[model samples]
Target chain A: MGNRTPLYEEHLRANAKMVDFGGWDMPINYGSQIEEHNQVRQDAGMFDVSHMTIVDLSGDKVKPFLQYLLANNVDRLKDKGKALYTCMLNEQGGVIDDLIVYYLGETFYRMVVNAATREKDLAWIEKHAAAYDVTVNVRDDMAMIAVQGPNARDKAHKVLGVAIADQLVDIKPFFMREMGDVIVARTGYTGEDGYEIMLPANQAPGTWRQLVEAGVKPTGLGARDTLRLEAGMNLYGHDMDENTTPLESGLSWTVAWEPEDRDFIGRAALARQKSEGVKRKLVGLVLEDRGVLRDHQKVIVDGEEAGEITSGSFSPTLGKSIAFARVPASVGTHCQVDVRGKLLNARVVKLSFVRNGKPCIDV
Target chain B: MSNIPQELRFTKSHEWVKREEDGTLVIGITDHAQQLLGDLVFVEVPEAGSSFKDSDDCAVIESVKAASDVYCPVAGEVIESNEALADAPETINNDPYGDGWIFKLKPEDEGAYDGLMDADAYAEVVAEDEH
Candidate 1:
């Protein structure tokens, strides 16, 4: 048995296939995974992201504390409700977790971390905060839901009412606004226009039912993974882990290097790595053959094992297979993947396979 | 409960076998099996003229979640393989019984086919596992 979110009963009512995801009994899909993936690309879809951990920080020195905590500079979040995507690193320059931090006020920020890395992330944050005067508050009573697609904002506004909808439409992307107990943010993992709503857990079930009635199809973890992959978003445990650095994980852009004196936690290690030259690079792969590419498959470059795939799947939008591989820096645009003892041809492209409901690379 | 056609024979591993009028045996995964595996992304059928023993793993079927092996119910040589699935594997999900047939086998011994379980028995096997 595992923990169930507030919408567990709703998922059951929709005939969802339940699976244990990172110790939470979450829905893998309501029905067909491909259909759910397509729905988010072409129309509106809702995902219960309540299993993610939310931590609120407040203090006189909260801004400076965040500057030394995250890899990206929080000093850039000058406007209220501005959010930044960054990696939290350890002393060894390895990722503790990737998170989104929203600056709500001068002394307050709301952060969301991955569900599987919740405990470790909290401990790291708390330990680092002891030196500063910041207070770390975990809001377990809050539930999150992400509604995403081309028409997602309109559908979400219809369910959330007119005033809130009007305010949400005016909010810029990667920005959020608080309305009573609900926080509506124009952020999404599916690379589509939508909002990620966080509200009291007790009020979640009713809101979910209303969204369903508004014709926002219910999606689950399976479709979420495919959608994120198509958008070229890096999953925490899959694309990188504690032992992998941001430089090797296609996350160098997330690290802020300006004002060299920022003196972040992993700054020294990253500086040392950069001077010595990074060894590996993350690249996207599209299988030109008839088989599906999968994780941990050996990547053959010039007839030798040069790398391995971190995430791979069939692209529902492209009607082919694609993957993310961490290969040697010298590897070229063409390589072969060893699938079940057969070497198949694949083409390397930019990090993302699809973006904004369209193919980012050639089909 | 999934649809279990009464006339076809079944294996505990979820493969369904049907004997053609020409004495060749046609095989595919059962509806219950395809439903459990979700959408099919790839299917690797055995090449024609290949031989296998009873209960031998002869083919590979993959979904987005995991991969599963389809075993040969009876010892036989492959007569025809379903090449159409190579381009569009979702046929197994759309029509798991008729157009989704995986392959045809020339059985080494006709009696070996009788040793497999019937539709009702296979249904019981699936039902017991669900609990």
Candidate 2:
């Protein structure tokens, strides 16, 4: 048996096929994954993402503590409700977990980390906070639901009522605002304009039902995977992990290094790698052959092993199979993905295969 | 009516075999197999002239999520294959027992279907797997 979310009964009512995801039984798909993928890309869809862990950091020392804890600078979040996406690193410069931190006030900040890495993340936050006057508090009482699409913000507001929904227009990207008890953030994982709502667990089911009744289609994890892939966002366990670093995982841009005096946990290791140059680099792959690109397949570049795919899937938006591969930094435009022992040619392009429902490459 | 047909036989791996009157056998992945694979995206059937032993990898069904191999339910030469699936593989999801059939084979031996499970047995197997 696995843990069930507050909306599990609602998912069952909608005939969602449940799958065990990190000990939590959740919906993989409501019916057709492809259809649900299109709904989010074309219209509106909501996802129950409460399985992700949330923690609150407090005290006047919160800002300083986060500066030493995360790879990205916390000072970038100058305004209240501003959010910053960053990766927490180990001493060896390997990524421990990637998370989004929301700056709420002078003494408090909120963070949502991956479910599988919750234990380590909590431990790391606590262990590092001991030197400062900060306190680490986990927010297990909140349930999060993400409504994403071009019209997602509009629909979510209409369903929640015009008075509350009207405030959504002013919530800029990577910013959040609280409406009554709901923490509505203008953020999303699907590379679309929308909001991620966080509320009490007991209120989640009713809120989900209300949103669904207001014409927001219920989406599942299957669509979530493909949508994130199409958006060029990395999956926690697949695209990168404890053994991988942000520099080699196409997330180098997220790192902040300016003041020579500011020493983060993995600063020295990353600084050394930065000076010496990185060995492997993560790049996007586009198939030119009749076959699809898949993960764990050997990537032959110039008839030699360049790298293997970290995450691969058939993109619903592009109608083709694409992948993210960690290849040699020197590897160029042409590569071959071995599928079923045969090398299928693929072209290496910059990441973000599909953005805002359009192809980044010229097809 | 959507259960495995009584006239056909099944393997433990979930392939269905329909032995024709002329000794030619029609082969396909069972409906249970298609359901497990989710939405079909591509089908890689064997060449018509290729011969295979029972339980050999004779075909492949690629879904939007994953790829699975379709084994030869009965050993024989593949006399014909359903090429219609190459353009649109969703037929397998819509009609797995009929239009979604993969290949036709002439059995090398008459007792090829004898060792396979009956329709009732295959249905029971699917039911048990649902747990």
User: Model 2: per-residue lDDT, tens digit, B2-119?
Assistant: 4678888998899888888887889898888887777777788899999999789988888878988989877789999999998778899889899999999988897877888998
Cα lDDT listed for each candidate: 0.92, 0.88
Model 2 chain A, TM-score vs. native = 0.98
- What docking tier does model 1 reach? medium
Instruction: List the candidates' TM-scores in order.
Output: 0.98, 0.97
**Ten-residue stretch with the least lDDT total in model 2 chain A:** A160-169
Model 2, backbone clash pairs (residues 3+ apart or across chains), number: 1
In model 2, the runs with Cα more than 4 Å from the true position are: none
Please report how far candidate 1 places residue A358 from its true position, in Å: 1.1
lDDT tens per residue, model 2, A1-363 = 787888899999998989988878989998788889998998899999989998999999999999999999988889999999999999988999999999998899999999888888888889889999899889988999999998788788877777777777777899999788889998889988889999999999999998898788999998999899888999888888888889999999889997778889888998898889999999999887766677788899999987999988788787778899999999988999999888999989888987777778867
